[model samples]
Target: MSFAEEAWVPTTETECRIEGWSKETHQHGLQVRSSAEMNAQVVGILPAYVINFDSHNFGIEFQIIGSDRGWLKIRGAKDDPNRSKLPIRATYPGIGWIPGEQVAFMVQSGSGHQRPDAESAKLLDLKGDWLTSMGKIVRVVACSGEWVLLDYSLGRSRNPQTLALKRLTEAERRASQGRAWFRGVCAIQETSCETSWP
Candidate 1:
């Protein structure tokens, strides 16, 4: 299936940050739109929302709440819990649009959530504007509060280089039933993330 199709896989993450790798190379911000279309409508802008020239990558770690014509529909922080705010009023204020350019893709916290975040999912992996921690890659089986469940079949044969997969004893294996919870992220990373599991 296409990215847009798999992006909203129920368990898929739905959050992302628009920024460049570094400020020295990138010195621009993202233009929030009313829709995904280029000519849709200029609602607001995310200051410093960047684009790295050295590394042509955009979409990184985030919970993708939306996917349409390459646009990711994410949640916007409202001024108050009352929810009376919109773009132009704030940076990416309310569920606005951020063009999915270059390498527009979303991922979880490496082993953050092996699966996708539900409607209440916010996997941007953004800690107040700083990109950090690239965890391992694992297929998500389940997710709890602040924890993600991973799936790795240690059956007759298993791949040693399966990213963040870990070896478990017969008891542990049976307990996990070929599934285990490891620390990782699903958000796509330009480099890689570490998965602490076994």
Candidate 2:
């Protein structure tokens, strides 16, 4: 279907993030179906693995490219810093279809300003002078289908804007198993990092 023909909606507007299905819900892992229906061909599997959220090296992130009938087609972030280093082939250029129920859309009320804590993130190209230059260091607050809510700090002002995901660099890709061991170990514990947040 054409991009214009598809009915794409953001999973969450407040936070702008989408989460994969948890292991508790699907023990075998999240399957990437060829179509939105249950009988569709199984294209791949996004394994269900747990990570230490308290650690700096949390997990890989995916960008929603398209959606239909409660199914989302996602791909790895293009400018992910760890993409080239990941061992899994599915992650570096990961792309597949997953059920809508398998994903969690996060929404935050208010401005919901989160301290810039992500190790690294790149701004997607907005093709407009009003937006920050493509690939500029940005603090990604949340992401939905096609758009990412980013915080661009220039001097004293913090500009929070939503831009297309295609414009950003892929900083990291999600592995089939949802485990990214290449991020290395977090030198500081969660408690120590908490003190650093503003």
Candidate 3:
């Protein structure tokens, strides 16, 4: 079945209310009024993948089951054996709700196109400092707004860096057009890298 036809399953653990508190009051040694109040309770913390974006710890990864406005309902992965085995449609335990800005999609392998003619792409900071003179081809791992998370080797080790979408030159932009990952991300936000600033 196609992805659109598949049913969404909730796999994450979330905070839920199981029971409420009750209070009773007595006047003149007789029960005058008994009141029951609801209390908010928290479930155990769910396991989540860490998103390394500018060393920020606010980012997390979860299975997106639903979305409303700018919030997303995310649950843990179904394949995780450590997670609780629950029914997919059960809503007794809710999932997490985070802002849309904290979530990014992963670029699967073989989904990216190649530009053999493009030898290397330049890396520049927001202030225009050339981070790499001869940067290797990197894959787009995740994207948020106008920034894309790239995995590239600086010297001997590989590292991830967040780059502005407009940093690429005209030629570089043309070269990256063949990449499926870039195209998918560009469809979300309109950004051009053809500027001649640096």
Candidate 4:
């Protein structure tokens, strides 16, 4: 995406530090974009919001972008009973997945969001930010309270070693399925944050 202005919270901010976040250099490097490139494709007329949960501190950062789809707010941890206070939205980004293919979920935490403040967090400037996969997209569902789940199937024969759009054999699929699992991280807003990569 065209990062007009990069917003980062530094390696400080007890709740949003970026030191301990998972970092993976994408084998298929992403194509960076410019503002003009961003204008080329409409992320749609609407904007996408982010819901950040700090499991350690039990705080959440609910941020929204403006009409320009720019981030509007960040680091909202106040105790507000009004759910509307946290405006959250989801974007498909046209990331596809197949019916029977294995897929992975990657998340950026800690200093991941950078500016934890309201101003920096509201930048809805996602242009070319995407993850390319070998699967086809089936459907995406949104839940109440700002939760969006992407449902997709992974073919048992897709080879992870072959990054250039390839599949594996039945034996390879079985070996992969045997070790499949899910894990998460915890961020102590304004205190400490850590990530677990498997």
Per-residue lDDT of 39-123 in model 1, one digit per residue for the tens?
8787765544234456543332234345454455544422221221223323455566554342222232322222344333233
Badly placed stretches (over 4 Å) of model 2 are: 1-27, 51-60, 77-93, 110-198
For TM-score, the strongest prediction is: 2
What is the alpha-carbon lDDT for the whole of candidate 2?
A: 0.35
Root-mean-square deviation of Cα positions for candidate 3 versus the true structure, in angstroms: 19.5
Candidate lDDT (C-alpha), each:
0.36, 0.35, 0.28, 0.23
Candidate 3 lDDT, 62-101, residue by residue in tens: 3444433333444552222222222232121334444334
lDDT of 2 at 105: 24
lDDT of 2 by residue, 1-198 (tens): 234322223353222224322221333556666665688887766544334344333233455565554555666522223422334434333666665445432211112112212332222212232222122212333334323343332211223464334322133211101100011111121222221111
How much is 114 displaced in model 4, in angstroms? 26
Model 1 scores worst on lDDT over the 10 consecutive residues at 16-25
Q: Find the candidate with the highest lDDT and give its number.
A: 1
Candidate 1 RMSD computed on C-alpha atoms after optimal superposition onto the true structure: 13.4
How does each model score on TM-score? 0.33, 0.35, 0.23, 0.18
By TM-score rank, best first, the candidates go: 2, 1, 3, 4
